[model samples]
Target chain A: EVKLLQSTDVTGGTFTLLLIGMIGTAVLLFLGTGWVSRKWKLPVALAGIVAMLAAAYYWQAREVWLTAGQMPVIYRYIDWLITVPIQVLALYFFIGTVARPPTGLFWRLLVVAIVMILARYMGEVGFMHPTLGFLIGIVGWLYILGEVYFGKLGEINTKSASETVQTGFFWLRLVVTIGWAIYPLCYFIGSFAGGVDEGTLSIVYNLADFINQILFGLIILYAAAKESATAR
Target chain B: EVKLLQSTDVTGGTFTLLLIGMIGTAVLLFLGTGWVSRKWKLPVALAGIVAMLAAAYYWQAREVWLTAGQMPVIYRYIDWLITVPIQVLALYFFIGTVARPPTGLFWRLLVVAIVMILARYMGEVGFMHPTLGFLIGIVGWLYILGEVYFGKLGEINTKSASETVQTGFFWLRLVVTIGWAIYPLCYFIGSFAGGVDEGTLSIVYNLADFINQILFGLIILYAAAKESATAR
Candidate 1:
């Protein structure tokens, strides 16, 4: 059974922002679902995944909204459990659908992203020694970096015919490396170093998720839209 | 006098990564310095500021490496004090020197950036209520956004001759809007909500700083380089 230490004093702002985040994602999900080509529809599905996760967050969080003082931490992780894996898979979908990389590179990219997200979930939930899990998480991140910078993925990006793929790959890699660095840092300091309170930690995670889910989905959508236009 | 509550344990990987991040910026600084023209020198100086900041972090973080349980909180803020103004100034400089936007935009952008950073700093150090500070900071950020998206700055971008300016501005603005939402979240949670520990807070700030400093510098350098060739 899932456990929640409920606080009846929930902040209106978090709930409000969670709802706003959900609605915004929902709009994008609709764009992907309604407008995108069937040949290039996965980005929309990826956006849909985020919308659902945001909805999941809103539903779980809002249910205890009146009774809970803080949003249930477990629901946040549960959202990640399903959403994070999908998010990584979405990136893999992007690499294949847009860049159309070779098979080995494609598999490696997907594997690294999965490992990174899974390890992070385990670390956060205390299923693993948090620091060790974080280290493993870093390894997964580093592996992705290697593929983007020094591996065949880099080669594919260099030679790709799609302008969107060429341009998107650079910024996508930047977003992944620099933006995602915060998670491990959070683990190291907040979870391991006794540095932050639950409120601060949740805020950081919320902010990161908003950017990660929304901005990343938009980029995928932009690329898919570009590809669809060209295909037509 | 500077005070540090010291700990005997140090994380070698963080220290090492900080060092590497610094070195990477240093190389960019040198490239901007030695290769760029006098007309386009501010971006190089911005890179120099980041390299110096990385050095300052290394120096401060390494000093208590053997005795400190965590990285010094004050030094992190201090680094921001020195670097933030320069980063804003760099943006102004890039707009002037590269995009060659009209005169008022330069000053407006600088003023907006400075006001935003100051509000955020004051909020972080507790001179004002965190939420209030964050909102004020957001105002400044929104001003920049308005200028870039709907104001004369957008007009300037459309007319700018350099491909680098066009390409760089698109991504740079995307970065600013997306990347900066974290600060307010941190303030709201850490300061307002009474959640988050100093260590976790520091880690978030550090990761944001590294990404903010390095990636922002690279975009400026790319623009400056493009502009310099045109001027030559």
Candidate 2:
């Protein structure tokens, strides 16, 4: 029985570490892309502040997980704080690219930031399942996909009369969108299949989450490199 | 023991009825608001559709509660479905009003529709702990308050070169916001002071919820009257 318990602890610890790593890598990718965008005169640089905070949140959450034997209750609080910036930046990028006479990156980011702040409460109060943390992360991926689809990928050229959409990231966008979509559907289905066993559903959800995050990280890296090269 | 069981049945039956009524009201409010927005050249009529479906989900969830008699099991689903629409519409209305601009009637009716939705969800899920529902409901109320504060509370004249914000509904917005805010805080404090018995928490929460719905319905009626007078 002691051996079994130790093994269980090991598994839980590893799983927690993996989730922390995914969140950290996602934050880095966001900052990296924003850096490239800033170099190109796009307003993405301002949104990078959100990315930095998210990285810090993941770092704290991971530390808590490593030290605390029980799930750190405060991890939820950190989860919420991190979600705010990501949501804001994601929506900012979306609206900035779509605006006919686009407003400054400020308004778009502000709106998204507020929405995310509100969403944080929803998650914190247990209004939605904590697993939603991973789900909300997909918004970042969606923004990237939207930018690529609309050919607004990379730095802005104010001197140019009109902006054109880029096609290089089409396949990358397709893969990410499809992958993120699957995570939610799997979650909904898993909820029913797992029934009253919260542990079972959490395991299934986390495994799918691990796969999704790794793929997401790869996509971000690919897009960042592609956009950087195009800039050169 | 038999009398106690009878009391339980009676309360459960009443809860079910109230839940149905709240959902019915939500659907009507959603449809009515959609019709009005469409006529006003606002493209957010689809958001109204999504909101209505979410209300329907709440409706079904309440039915499950009435039948299942197992609060934990039924509530898990109810909480999930309700949160989606609340979050979705919260973001939708914020962006919609900012983007398309709407008349005073839109904000008023939206508050009503959202309150109705909140009442039903609270009745079913938060009935046992009204403070939770009340706290969640306040988030929605604040969004409307923010709208009014930002001056998105008036009619849009499509032909005009620029739109103007109106503040005629200032008092109405204030009353609704304050009233909703009080429910959660009051109930929470009351529950703590009175001692945290399950039955007591349920009663306080349910009573606060009923008051919220009644206030919401009144706002809708007021909005409808204002809209008619303005049209004439």
Candidate 3:
């Protein structure tokens, strides 16, 4: 008899967690936007849209995983391709709340973010040599880190007068540097390490995504809420 | 070899339609709430929440059906038990904009809507005799129709001065009367028809829900927008 999942199933359990993470975060971010002033609402609502987009993908991914008993790699990448870029762009908008960053910074970060996700996707799906794809993806990520931490974006953050914006920038940069490390680490292990199964990789990916997407958005929301409070 | 679904699959196609219906409706309703006056925002948001709630359940149902190749009966019922009652309660609040529905009317409609869903659920799952369960379910639905159409709620609608509300009331009542008939019709056929396949029944039900939930909300949103426009 075919069954969607048993209560004790491990992978199914992780899928449930991601589903909850996406939906819960979306609701909180949407509701949270209402409390903040108009200037900060866009960033907070952008965070919410990220969660909602991920939630839709997770629905399809859950179906794919449960029925096929296989990793839903394509769905995950499709989600990342759209959401990750928006997330990168969200940093641009988040900074805009305090002072306008150069418009060039916006397009630069967008391009880099898309390249990062695309390179990794190509590697995972065999469009390029895995090592080449991995290396390109790493370069794209490091470029973002440099741009946000030590490049023009970083310079703007240091000059911003709002302590709330400064604090938000510090944490956002840290997330890009540290929280994002899990993706490459998992990719290296899955591609280069011998004998790692798909199920383990899938679960780890789900957990990483839960941290990556939801936590990233929550940080933006916290900053927005704080900025709004201080202004009043 | 198990597969989630092929591109040309009919049941899978219907599932896709329902997924799109729920998510699309939720987004539209949420966005539409912004253009409306503050007084009408609550009702619009409620409609969005109904769609959002159904979207979550549809994710599970899609997984269950794709994996198990079964009807996903329980998921659908669980969804109905929550959302159908909320839709009924939404009517109470919708009418509240032009006139306060009797508090008793709210409680009565809620109770009856729940009974209608639960009775059908019990019969479908074999927890009660099919014929008796169907009869009770029909009675519950008919009672709701009478109350909304010819009883105290109907009385309030007729007395309301707003043309927008009157038109909305007409469409909303028509949905309850006509749009909702598919559920019992499907139930009766599934229980009594000797040769109906589960796949056909599932597709039909999905289409009905697309009508019942999304169309029902759209009618309300249209009226609310109209009311807002007229007031301005």
Poorly placed runs, candidate 1 (over 4 Å): A1-12, A62-66, A71-73, A102-114, A120-127, A230-232, B1-232
Q: Candidate 2 residues A120-154, lDDT tens each?
A: 34555688764574356445435545543453333
Q: Over the stretch B1-232, how does candidate 1's per-residue lDDT look in tens digits?
A: 3444334322534555666787777666655665666646645655565565565456546544434545544444445544555565565566655456676776676677767766665665577765676788789878877877787767777787777777877877776677666666666677668867655665566566566776777777777777677777
Sorted by lDDT (best first), the order is 3, 1, 2
Best by lDDT: 3
lDDT of each: 0.63, 0.41, 0.80
Query: Per-residue CA lDDT of candidate 3, range A1-232, in tens?
Result: 4456777678877887788889999999988878887667667776787788788777767766777777645556656766787788788888777677888888888898988877776666566777888898899999888888887778888888888789888888888887789888887787678657888888888877777788889989998898889889
lDDT of 1 by residue, A170-195 (tens): 76677767767766676677656886
Model 2 chain A worst lDDT run, 10 consecutive residues: A1-10
List ranges where model 3 is wrong by over 4 Å.
A1-232, B1-3, B125-127
**Lowest summed lDDT window (length 10), candidate 3 chain A:** A71-80
Winner by TM-score: 3
